[model samples]
Target: MTMPEQITPTGDMTVQTENLCAIFGGCAKCPGHAKAIDCGLVHLNPDALVFCIHGCHQLRVREKA
Candidate 1:
């Protein structure tokens, strides 16, 4: 699946792709993250969080340490 352009809450436009999960990072915290990646609906943005457009709609965000 192709990535979709979406407007983020901060008003910045972000792009996502099927390979995003691998590019940014895998969503190990949530099961849905992996499912979305497998389904090719979730994409990742370096500046934003990873989320699924279909299936689980899981949001993946890196927690600051």
Candidate 2:
């Protein structure tokens, strides 16, 4: 028997493949700063929140700490 081919992450979440966008808040080094930046690869979680894969240090969609 042959096993099914595994799907690679491709640096993106399967759930939020469509309409993906990063929602950044605050500076990467500082939390006090609030800002938003557009990300190339963004994935949404169960709650439908966007997250950045690059780890820009900005506020991600969900708990990406």
Candidate 3:
């Protein structure tokens, strides 16, 4: 069996207003890199530099990778 993908999340309605967000280096440039939405979104945390919006979704596994 293969390992599972980690869960993640995101933010920003108008786009890259969150200059601190690293989601796609910035929400503005972020494509729908969503493997499952729950694990696709990225954000920043007060305790952690990087954070996920959700924590119950698994990312899809690419056959090529």
Q: Which regions of candidate 2 fall more than 4 Å away from where they truly are? A: 1-47, 57-65
- Candidate 2 per-residue C-alpha lDDT over 1-65 given as tens digits, one digit per residue, 9 for 90 to 100: 12112222345443222221222333353332221222223223323323334334345577668
TM-score of 1: 0.21
Q: Please, what are the lDDT tens digits per residue for candidate 3 over residues 1-65?
A: 12224323345321222222244444454433333332333333222232323222236778995
Per-candidate Cα lDDT values, in order, are 0.39, 0.30, 0.33
Residue 22, candidate 2: Cα error in Å is: 7.0
Residue 44's lDDT in candidate 2: 37
User: How much lDDT does candidate 2 score?
Assistant: 0.30
Please identify model 1 stretches exceeding 4 Å from their true place: 10-45, 56-65
- lDDT for 65 in candidate 3 is 50
Candidate 1 lDDT over 1-65, as tens digits, reads: 24434323334335332334332345443333233334434234344434434423445788999
The best candidate in terms of lDDT: 1
TM-score for each candidate, following the candidate numbering = 0.21, 0.17, 0.20
Q: What is the lDDT of residue 56 in candidate 3?
A: 21
Q: Which clashing pairs does model 3 show?
A: 8-39, 9-41, 9-42, 9-53, 10-41
